[model samples]
Target chain A: MGTGYSIRRVERQDYEGVLQALSALTTVGSVSRTQFEETVDHWNHVKVSSEPEILQYHPYVVLHGEEVAATGMLFIERKLIHGCGLVGHIEDIAVSLHHQGKQLGRALIDHLTNLGLRHCYKVILDCDERNVRFYEKCGYSRAGVEMQRR
Target chain B: MGTGYSIRRVERQDYEGVLQALSALTTVGSVSRTQFEETVDHWNHVKVSSEPEILQYHPYVVLHGEEVAATGMLFIERKLIHGCGLVGHIEDIAVSLHHQGKQLGRALIDHLTNLGLRHCYKVILDCDERNVRFYEKCGYSRAGVEMQRR
Candidate 1:
């Protein structure tokens, strides 16, 4: 029940906090500072334009008193067919274990989905079955099959 | 068997041929010349570098006697977890009806997968059950469940 918790685009200084928050979602090992910088630099470069929504790779973080409690990324992809020119793919969503019940995950998803709706015909994401109901409650209905390489 | 038939990166001049080949994959409506030009320009901008691999969006076409008979696109994505940094996503694969039995699809898949292996720990693609067997034969085995929004 903390106040002044806001969600915003990640900044350079937020890398460490963001990484710490992401570790709870998976085994985040020793990622070099250079790698982190490179990833953020690439993301910043991609988001330079607003007209071409696909150019913007938005990575948002939930800040509770300047501490990154959660993070998510939305990448825009341009589609060539189906009259769907732009699409949004959501990935890298994670909420720190301590901040789990604060609804930060839902907030991040809503924020990304809102951005997607403004610029893309569809915003899609793939998740494990366990997380399917959560996304369904967020307005995403069951769609097609998802297969991956072994 | 045309002597000049080969697979190569799509050149600016291959627009018309590429369009012709892509039409067979789906009911491609009247895509304006400007749209085609813009797409090629976008692809060119994305592939300005090769070191990162993720920045190089490869669009390849199979040329059969000065005509583009098949086309495919490979887009690289970077992952932050799972010890995997870069992942290759295959998309927009199409072959002209006349070129169906020539194994062009396999050729395109192999070319992209090989490039992926060099810069990425793993390459993955999503396909309907109908096309899973084809990809399995290309060395991609069934792995995880794919669930998406409707």
Candidate 2:
């Protein structure tokens, strides 16, 4: 809890700030402002719609005095198993280099994890080995191995 | 490649069969027929709608004559990374005990992976240690570690 630090749902105006925060995680490339607005609009619409909960997208950003310092997203997946339960996938979590050691990453992760746990039976994520200890400290444990075909 | 074996999109009528197949993977519990239909209907509607591709769900079942032998689902996730690219999550892949070794599981995985790759930059999944080799044989390499709070 540093002064001037706050966390909230990402808004359209945070487009560039969010991307700057995400660059700490992976290559975000050049995303036009129009494309960002359109995607955020669609995601917001899904978040509030009567559609199946599986389509829900919850994205959050941490602001250090109006600057996006960290970001994370939670996706709810519908499943037939466990009596039609919901599973949450946490993705794209990042904290800007300058913001490291401030616990902003943990804050964003906890915020997203709590939001996901509200409606999900289980919340899961995949991360690099170096980050495993950090996530474990965040109350997550090793569950399985991530496999990919890219 | 066996006679009387076929894989196709799951129909509303395949609800019970799909649940039966899923039980081989984990506890499915008791899901009313009506609940199954309603969820399937919603998923199908999203699958066909122009409402963001992230809402799209592709579920498939392998039929052995009139019986369902296997099932799998692919969820397309919209992302701001990679220039607003798509990522596919393959989930709930299972095969009936009697259907094991028939390559139905492999067939379903391949079908879903190819379907996902057509629109996704990458297809990803999480699996237990026992199933890791099988997925690796299906062209998926270990990408990262799966962490969860359940």
Calculate DockQ per candidate and list them.
0.42, 0.83
In candidate 2 chain B, what residue range of length 10 has the lowest lDDT sum?
Answer: B46-55
Model 1 interface RMSD, one decimal: 3.0
Kindly report the docking quality category of candidate 2: high
| Tens-digit per-residue lDDT, A1-150, candidate 2 | 588999888789989898888888898987999888877876776631254333478888889898888888998877889988888899998888889899888888888898888878899999988899999999999999999998
Tens-digit per-residue lDDT, B1-150, candidate 2: 489998888888998799989999999987999878876876676531264334478888999998999999998888899888789999999999889999988899999999999888999999998889999999999999999998
Best by lDDT: 2
What TM-score does prediction 2 earn?
0.94
Q: After superposition, how far is residue A38 of candidate 2 from its true place, in Å?
A: 1.0
TM-score against native, each model:
0.86, 0.94
- Judge candidate 2 at residue B64 and give its lDDT: 93
Residues forming the 10-long window of minimal summed lDDT in candidate 1 chain B: B141-150
True-structure RMSD, every candidate:
3.0, 2.1
